[model samples]
Structures are given as structure tokens and as C-alpha cells.
Target: MVENKHVLEISSVTTSDRGVYTCKASNRFGADICQAEMAIIDKPHFIKVVKGTNTVLQCEVAGTGPFEISWYKDKKQIRSSKKYRLTSQKAVISLEVSSFNSADVGEYECVIANEVGKCMCSATYILKDWQTPLIS
Candidate 1:
């Protein structure tokens, strides 16, 4: 017989709570039983990138679920270009650039999102404008 109806009500659920759960219900003549299993997983870490000759943004995460990745420049979504390349795997993801130029100077963000949650990391590279060279 079920002592209480509310058995799975809690404030927060975590990975530790993953296991088999049983609920027993009984009547005057017979009894019925139910069982279930649960699993809790954590979201992935943010992607990070640095400014250099060939800049690449890397994102790391875990789990077998749908994931979405995007690159942003100056808070705007960056469409596929000749200089930008994107690659991904189960735990590793990256955005590679063939070369860096003055136009690439700005805040760059890498976003990784799933049905459960999302995480983001960003880096900024500023370039100084130069004037024409003077002839002697």
C-alpha cells in the first residue's frame, strides 16, 4: 500500500537522484506495483577563443542530446563565410578561421544550447587603425 501519494516532489533534482523508484498501491483484494528510473545530467561548459594568427573557438560538452551552436560577431550572428568553418563532435566543437584581419576585431561569442540548458563564452580582440607610410 502507498503510504503517501506525493513521493517524487522535491525542490531540485540532481544526478544523485538517478535510480530505480517503486510505487506500491494496494486495494482490498489485490495489489499493484510500478517502477521507474531517472537520470539527471549537467550542461556543458562554455566555449572559449583567443585572438591569434589563426583563431579557433572551441566548445566542450557532454550527453546524448540535441545541441545547437552558433558564432556571433559584435552581437550579430555570423553567417557561413569563406574564412569561417565549423566542426563538431560528441564532446568537442570548434569554429576555425583561416586568417585574422582588421575586420575581425570585435567581440566574438560561441554559444552552445540544448533542450536542457545553454552556455556561452566570449572574447574580444581590438585592432588599431594605421595610416599610410610616408616616403622619404
Candidate 2:
């Protein structure tokens, strides 16, 4: 006697993967199908940098690539330049915003995407002003 069977495993699944998945089997007579669904885990951590100094905003990602990484300041997309530097190594991507100032103190968003899917995350950076207050 012989039996045919198979198995599928998913690692580090997110909310998007929670939907129902269908598996189909066929024989000479007819066909059979099965389905399964599951929930998953998820967040952003805070980052701090000194005022008027260079700062790096990094995002951590997992799974397969080629991946696209992007940085945003206050809902606006940011690009790489002399003042802004972008770097990527494996699962980590970073954006360096040069000369961190009052204008740069705000919410930042890091968007990571691959052929499989896309994930968006946000974190806030607090600025520590180095300028001393003038005496009256």
C-alpha cells in the first residue's frame, strides 16, 4: 500500500497572512479541498539623537528579498543625498539625516517591501538641544 501527503510551513507571519489558505487534492473520481487560518504578532521602538548631530533611522526586516526601503519625515518621503545618507545590509536598512535639528525632531516612518509583501512601521526621535540659554 502507498500513501501521498505533504506539509507547508510558514515562518514569522503577519496580519496579512491571517487569511484562509486552501489546499486542493484530486483523484480519478473527484477533488477534495482543505483550508486553515491563523493570527500573528506585530511594533516600533523609540530612537534618540543629539541636536545638530548626525542621526540614523533604522528599520529591521525579515524574510526574502529583493527589498525596497524608504524613509519618511512627518509623512513626507525622504531621499538620499549629501545631507541624507541611506544604507542597507541584509535585514537592516538605515537612513542618516545629517545635522539633526529642531526641524528634524518629529515622527518618522520606515517602509520595507519585498516581492512577497510590504510592511510599514513608525518611530519617534527626540532631540536634545545643545545650545545654552542666554542670561538676561
Provide the TM-score for each candidate, comma-separated: 0.66, 0.54
List clashing residue pairs in candidate 2: none
Model 2: per-residue lDDT, tens digit, 8-80?
8888766677777889999899999999876443332223322222466665666555676778878989888
Model 2 global lDDT (CA atoms, 0 to 1): 0.65
Model 1 / residue 58 / CA error / Å: 1.2
Off by over 4 Å in 1: 1-12, 24-32, 39-44, 47-53, 62-64, 127-136
Give lDDT tens digits, candidate 1, residues 1-136.
Answer: 8656657674687667778888888879989999998766666564333333446666676643577778898899976778888778767777776666666767778787777787887777664434221111
Worst 10 residues of 1 by lDDT: 127-136
* Residue 51 in model 2: lDDT: 26
Clashes of each: 0, 0
lDDT of each: 0.68, 0.65
Q: On a 0 to 100 scale, what is the lDDT of residue 114 in model 2?
A: 60
